[model samples]
Target: MDYIGHIKLVNGQVPSESLLLDEANIAASRRVDLHVQTHDDPVLKLCLWDQAASEFWKKFRASGGTARVVLVTTLNPKRYGVLSLSSMTPSRVFLDGDIQETRDYLGWLSLNQDVANRLNADVVVKPEPATLGELFSYMKRASAKVAWFECTAAIDNVVHGSKWYYIGCGDCHPKATKGPTTLLCRKCGKSEVVGVAQYLAKLSVYDHNDQAFFVLLGDAGEELTGKKAAELVESYYEANDGVGDDDIVPVPQVLIDTIGQTRTFIVKISTHNLDGKTQTLTVTKVLPLEAPAPKVKSGDEVDVELCNEREDLADESVKRAADGVGSEDAKRARCG
Candidate 1:
């Protein structure tokens, strides 16, 4: 039977093949255990003997062990402790060299972190484009298809995660009660107000195949929402003079607009083992996606846009830093 699969693991040749006299028989003596994944099985083992093993090894090395794509033609299904694939004398193996399926498999392998990390670093190749479903599959395993892979996804929805900020006693407690001129910290039993900002955002992003969740930190959230945490709180206060403990604040309008927009992002994917039996993929890092430009335009519009974006970011960074320290004082002044 012929099978199209991606090589997951490759073992060293069996001993005594170099001692054979006949060329064909000597070739048959060389054997390698290959762990491959076919369309039917998520993982399957194949034993390549003699000539097939020798030729496959050369191609695997040439691909720097990253060329995981392969097509095994002419193999027998046999029981060796369990069901496995055995190579025949006439079996032929093709690497990523000329087969389209092999090329597609290479892209698929890029999404598997474990497979990608085990590959030789000298390969220095980028993964092929993949859908959200493919990315999730790669992450579901113990590792990723490739180290430091990127994905392009559309914002399916925005999830409200942590509190925007805590308003409390100016010095004793971050969350406090606001009076006419002074703040009261019930926990600290003091009267002074200070505001501390906490920004944690979670976004559900997807491509055609499926969806996954990503976490965004303060800076990333601010960039996406176009408003600082302090600003969001201030806006809330302006609309309603008093906020109760149970009052729910709405998300910033800017952030709401991000739903359905496409962006590219660098992802750090991992899996966590639970109780030695179950594992789950942890997908993180939500930031603006960046890719190489196809060609430089003759005009300065591209340059201007880049410069403006950078300048805005720089300005926001400085503003947020200042707000972090002075926001409490500003709030006190406004209330006083």
Candidate 2:
């Protein structure tokens, strides 16, 4: 049997608000053998979402087809919490954290060494545009007998594949490399890629009353490094008791240099408003060591005496003319 590349049918716009469900139903009717699979899956799989998911399952059951649903999304701990609330049963849900997690997830599938082998289908979910290149590369290198699917908001990004089918809006087809614009899909005109950016923009709004402050790190080092810096600053603040903000506290250069050596230690203090604006204060201080004292003689006392008082001690006549005291040589001669 000849190998067939995986097919990706994207619903670029939300099915709840748009005619995506009606369009998907039409496509499904035409290609009854359609299977869904994620990029990480070794085989094609199905995706379940909104109202069409129920209808698709019903049709599959009626046709004696096995229900294979793949759930791909962010690996939030809360996702499991929400799953407990939902009654939907998927063949298996592959959990991935990020692009890095996708690598491990695919590895397990490719090896056929784990639970992934038992799943009816696998689907990769919530892929970012940056990782698309890596995903395509992995697909090309895989030796497993599997198919792939892409759930992208931008359907024009899909590569051509043997089993590929376009599903969604008429305009949702892949963009021509270059030429006079053609509305018809080069492979098939039944479905095409569409623009859904406008609708997505509306859902970006949030309530201002329940705003949360988030500090985004830009070119900053590791969490440990930041924590160390914060600890050092906290120590300084605590040791000084109540130093004013404007006070110039001398910090040891050795400590400052040691902290600076850590590439990840950028100190950023910030406050956020419900309006989505942030005020940030950066802490930059250099501490230096104290100056050393000059060396001096032991038990030496430096006294400043008047020049006039020292003149009498220096003159020989002033010493001999003194009434009470005489020179030691004169006293010995008079006694002999």
Candidate 1: tens digits of C-alpha lDDT, residues 196-248: 54344446677777766654444455655666666886677788877874575
Candidate 1 residue spans exceeding 4 A from truth: 1-131, 143-149, 160-195, 270-336
TM-score versus the correct structure, for each prediction: 0.36, 0.18
TM-score of 2: 0.18
Number of backbone collisions per candidate, in order? 20, 14
lDDT of 2 by residue, 109-158 (tens): 45653443343322223212212333233334423112221211111111
User: Residue 66 in model 2: shift from native, Å?
Assistant: 18
For all candidates in order, the CA lDDT equals 0.53, 0.26
Residue 250 C-alpha lDDT in model 1: 60
- Candidate 1 weakest lDDT stretch, 10 residues: 327-336
